[model samples]
Target: MAALTCRQVGNDFFKEGRWREAIDKYTDAINLDPNDHLSYTNRATTYSKMKNYTAAIRDCKKSIEIEPKHIKAYYRLANSLKMLHCYDESLVTFNTFLGFEPNNNLAQNERTQVKTAIFKEKLQGAQVHPALRILSWANCDNDPLSCKARLLAATLEFNKGNEDGKNRNVKGLIEITEGIMLDERCFIIPSSINLAVNTAFEQNKALSPTLSVRATILKYKQRLAQDGWDSVLPALATNIRAAFLIGYMSRFTPDVRNIDQGIENIRRAIELASFATEIAPVATDDINSIDPILKITFLRTLKVHLMEAILIKYKRNIEMIDLFDKVLQLAKEVIESCNENPISTEDTISYCAYYRGHLEEAYGAIGSAYNERSKFSRGELGFQERDLKLLLESVKNYEKANEYFPSDDPKFALFHYLTASYKLMIGGCTLHEIKQHAQKAKECEKEAYPVFGNYLGDIFEKSMVFQALEQLKRPNNIASDDKYFLPQACHVSSNSEEEEQRFIREYEARTGGTIAATMDLSQAAARANAEFLRNGISIISSDKQ
Candidate 1:
């Protein structure tokens, strides 16, 4: 077939590092057989490699139009779009990737990265005043310190997760400035200082945006090396640079540049999540969420692009495994897409943790969900309640997933299965046998399974699928925090009359048992006492005779 010849030429070109030639051959293949999904997909991938975003998107899209399930095409399109800084479109693409392989960590991380980019854009027009920091400070209208304070506040708020609102709160923008300024060499927080200074200067509104960012980044780079940790510091600096770029460029680029920064920031946030996952628990209260909660440019297409980068790109660069781990964390954070109600956030977090190799955390999280399963009102169960069956299916998925899941592999399948087992136990499933089964799951997983492959990417790299076969047994001793990552209010839109009724039913169940027992205690006691006295007298008479 002429099409086959063209495809072979294209693939040969791709292998020989002639990306331009590969793109041409892929195009020729498509021309020969317009219906061939591979031709368009191959060409699209080549276009992405070449950074020819428009052509990449076009070819990938054509492949998808012809075959809706052309996941590779979707991935290529998303990547091309990300390169072009079209985040929303990319998000849609990544979403499609997730639909096909919900377990893919790359897609999830890309989604988070994109989301952060989107977030940065909305943050551009942040109001500023002494009290508001990120936004304008309203109440400090009469104060002499109002002008400088507001500007300081804005930078402070930007450092926090407020996409728009500034340091209006007492922890006002100025305090962060104070925190950084008090210790010029605050090796404990280079990102924070860099973030604050960058924010303050960019929000000056009086200076050239480009010049301001360039200067701030220059300063940021000089001091960035002070922060510790060998592998993670560079990624952190990249993130801080992204933040500075976002704020400084806001004036000149408006939405466009902000989107790019946001995309970058989300990537950073994922990095931060990865950092936090491995770090020791510091006793100090850090009430803050990771900074720069960027909006993911999550289109189903972009997810595919990110996913491919992890599987294909990282396969060649094994050192990027840590980054991929973060990507997995970011993905698990966003892509659950489960509706509210009985669908447990615990389960969601646990699943993500499972994929990331935090097995104990995963089990603890899932166990929390299972025990709390009976707590939600029937009316409050939302469509996510349907996940109950899916949850059971997930148990099987984890069982099988762990069968090949790595003990040290970030895919944390053993934890997910154990969590599922705990949930099953609470739900009146065979508790004792489930324990043995759970133990076996851990033992088999630890003893078996290979750790040779990169992270899981189901679409293009199907050959590397099911790499890990088993992991060793471990106890789930980590105390359950039972805290919700996503707010509980998200579960129920608003408690309805139906929910009200269910609430009453639950309330009655708790109180009714005690009330009944109390009522029966007096009467039952009198009868027992009478019988005891009668038997004692009769026994005494017999002894006397």
Candidate 2:
């Protein structure tokens, strides 16, 4: 009775936020009855409130010792450890708690928080070449982090190795096979967190660790050709990244067998990303709910879709009308999304730049698609009117792309060239109109000549299309039938085999090693926001940036 009275007094003191008084009362309760588990737990709560997590942990352990099944003792101990940044221990404790009360949402959320903390810590510590770091994690047991890391690494390696002329030694195929095997392992995590705990505690339980690396890779390939997104862990961000990487990489490869697979993967990424944007938080007042990663993923997904459509056009896998319709639909969706999510003060300057770049790319892709459709429709009877209209629309979209593109960027010269090409392709244009477009093309050529000359000298000098544009600049050389110039103008918009190779070499030279060295800083920022939430602070209110 005396111990109960002391505990009640301590509770009242705790309620009043009197930390010292509460600790004194709880100590009295402990003195009255040393084995009282509730008293120890109450005292631990007081210690935690006082920001003395060490003392709280000690008392929590004592309470659990006195009463093994005391549930609050486990909760208090786990939270105290989390406060101390003892994430691994906290994760184990939370798992033990969930073992007793499996349906407790609070405990489940806390457990996920611990896992996220562990993931973020590991990601920070494992900073190196993204592929190497991811591959290193893949070599570990089949935990969630290891599985996701392997997938990310596989994609990076594949991107690095896709171009045959450069980085052929990156061994992307080996990493991709390993990633698929681990993806099979990821299927095990969603059923029960205990499976993860068991895999962590006992290495032999995991299948990947037991098999030889080559055997494991072959086994996964034989068992499953391609694992669907549904079979993997249901993390939206991870799925988006995986689908984008796999799809984008597969499509760009020269292998003919991979084209269909690549298109399927890209479509899956677009579907997932579109769904994510639809559900994203729209209330500007609640900035904490917004995830910038989702926005980035959506933009990248759109870019991939555009790339795939262009590939289809080049490959002639689909009819011209179908290609035009698909690209126009995508362009409409992208334009709408861009208008709805206009850049605000909350967005970083780099994010705004990235967003604008994608917008430019999107418009440019639309113009290119329209131009291709017009080219294919040119000889068809009763389609001349439609073809001319398509060319006009292509010119308009190219102008919009130029508007979004940064004027000082070297790539702006390419946009100017594309715009001039489409403008000159317009039928029935007068000599004055041809001369105007020719002047703009000449100016862009002169501006880009110095920058691109050394790298692209031979290709530019040999290009007949450039020579035609140079002739168009002189009114005296204007042919009465400008139809002869149309074919040359068309060639200006598309890269020749030699020009494409030179551009790739120039790109590699300009961005050497930087791509491998750079990591996604946006993900780091999101992790910081998540950490703030874990600490019970409003991320928006603590705007340190």
Best by lDDT: 2
Model 1 C-alpha lDDT per residue in residues 1-545, reported as the tens digit of each score: 99889999999999998998887787788788889999888887876676555666777777889999878787777767665546767787888888888888887898888788667644743321212221221121222112222223233333342322143232222334222221111112224444443454444211233334445344434444454333333333333334333432232333544544544433343443344233423323332222211212111112322332333333334344464454444334333421111222233221111222222222323332323332222355232122345345335434543433334333343444444332332232322233345455445444223211222223211211111001111112211221110011112112333543343344346556443233221122222222322233221111110
Off by over 4 Å in 1: 125-545
Candidate 2 ranges beyond 4 A from true positions: 1-234, 274-289, 296-320, 344-346, 349-355, 377-386, 427-465, 472-545
Across 70-124, the per-residue lDDT of candidate 2 in tens digits comes to 9999999999877655677788899889889999999899899879977876676
Question: What is the lDDT of every predicted structure here?
Answer: 0.40, 0.52
The residue-level lDDT of candidate 1 at 252 comes to: 31
- Which 10-residue window of candidate 1 scores lowest in summed lDDT? 464-473
Candidate 2 clashing pairs, residues 3+ apart or interchain: none
Candidate 2 global Cα RMSD: 23.2
* TM-score of each candidate structure, all chains considered together: 0.25, 0.40
